[model samples]
Target: MVQELMLTLQALGLPRPVRGTLASQLVREFHGKVSELLPSLPPESMQPLLSSPLDASQWEALESLSQSLTEQYCCRRCLLLKRLDLTTSAFHWGDRAEGQGEAMKAVLFPIRGLLTPESDVSVAHVLAARADLSRLVPATSVAARQGTSCAINKVLMGDVPDRGGRPDALEAAMPAWQSRREDGGRGKAGPQRWGRRKKKKK
Candidate 1:
């Protein structure tokens, strides 16, 4: 059958000038199988130019072809976080809304692949979903603290006073208790009697 296939391939303009070695014969057979698989593809696509003991041009062509394929095959659409429902462990895409067209298309959640540990999703899954690691890397504690400090500094710089400092502008605006404290706790009680002691009841 292989001999017949080879003869057929030769009839279709494939070169077989020499009765080659077993290795060469196997290569030709493999090429023939590939040609059968992709009958409509150009000669360049089916060229095994990068077979072991290759040439410089073949190496260059292989690299260029690989890069071209990579560019063509790269995924165009990416998942962007729109609304995250932590309670339900689900998230919606930017364009999807809760009552939009189909319920399945509106939200997505991690599905357990199988009943095996190997199939469980991990941090790697999250890493893979991140478009840019530099942007996705979490804010450091020090950075968070610095931001908080800046916010506090801005607040301190405003009309609000520090803990121990008195606000002169707020003296009249003080609470009743604070005013009473300043006035020796006077007006809070009823009038005091002067030296009149009541007589003993008969």
Candidate 2:
């Protein structure tokens, strides 16, 4: 069935992106319709239909089902929009900005702490502190080495322990990994090393 779909897509002679978008939309529509239909279908019929390669007639039925589902969705959405228009017709347009601002504030009030800054520290001071700390710290330490190895092991096993005050402590622990060279010097001797490369070229 997938092979047949691929062949049909290739026969269109469309560009790769166009063909890909068309294929994805068709698949999504088909799956959406199928999901709606699945609950009503018997267990006995489902296994055979799912396992077997669909014939031309079955594919046609699926296409028709998808078309019907899309039409129904469009009709429902149109009715909903009509109802919304009728409901909002009496609403005052002049106070929209103030009303919207109040509504947004009310919605965000519960989670304001998550959005707001935790400290009074300025950006410059924080950056200077970070630079000074980097200079004071050794190139490699026992804790850093342990953190690096622990990080790798945790990543493989999918069980990393969180650290206090630092979300990216494991990642930042590997100072040796940050530099291109093991000696902790700048990258290779070339013009490319001194400047940022074009994203497209990279």
Candidate 3:
């Protein structure tokens, strides 16, 4: 089912950015629909879907749903990181006054995602649930790494656990893009001077 969905979506040849946006939209829609339905449904009806003993087909469906959710969570994190890195690169080389404003905006989304509580539970608990499901459904391992990346991003973006009010704490916690910018990649100044220069005339 997952494969079929991916294939159908990919068939449209949507660019990566579009694909990601679509995925995010779908995820948000799914959450919204479930949230709406969950409350209205009686507890008796919910139990079978939530904790009932599943035979074969229902269990498979549950596994598929878990896999889809985890994968989308990871993809969203990656998209956020990618956007942050691009903004950081631009700010690093731009005028400080303008850069500061851009930097503030760039960090907002990831910070919100990191700090906001999901379902009133800690991220560790959420991850533990994913781990339990992974053990039961080995197929989840394929997408598990992406989920791990998202979890790590959350920690890195959040406040330092033991260190408080230290100026260097954030610098130390900076994402991989910081190092790349420092090393003269996209953030580097001046135009490329290589490639075939004017040929020495005979």
Per-model lDDT: 0.49, 0.54, 0.56
Higher-scoring candidate on lDDT, 1 or 3: 3
TM-score of each: 0.17, 0.23, 0.24
The ten-residue window of minimal lDDT in model 1 covers 75-84
Model 3 residue runs over 4 Å out of place are: 1-51, 97-202
Top lDDT prediction, candidate number: 3
| Candidate 3 lDDT tens digits, 1-202 | 4654565446543323343466677566556656766777555443222333457887677667766776776677677667766875675565674647756766665665563212222323433352234335443476765555555455545555674767766455555543435664666765767777788899
Q: Taking the tens digit of each residue's C-alpha lDDT, what string does model 2 give over 1-202?
A: 5655665446543323453467567767556756776787655443321335668997778667666766676677667656755654445354775567666556545654343222223323322342224335543787676655654455455567855666655364544445445554665655545677678864
- Write the residue-wise lDDT of candidate 1 on 120-168 in tens digits: 3332333234223234434566756666555445544447655764566
Error of 1 at 130 (Å): 33
Name the lDDT value of residue 75 in candidate 1: 28
RMSD of candidate 1 to true structure, Å:
22.8
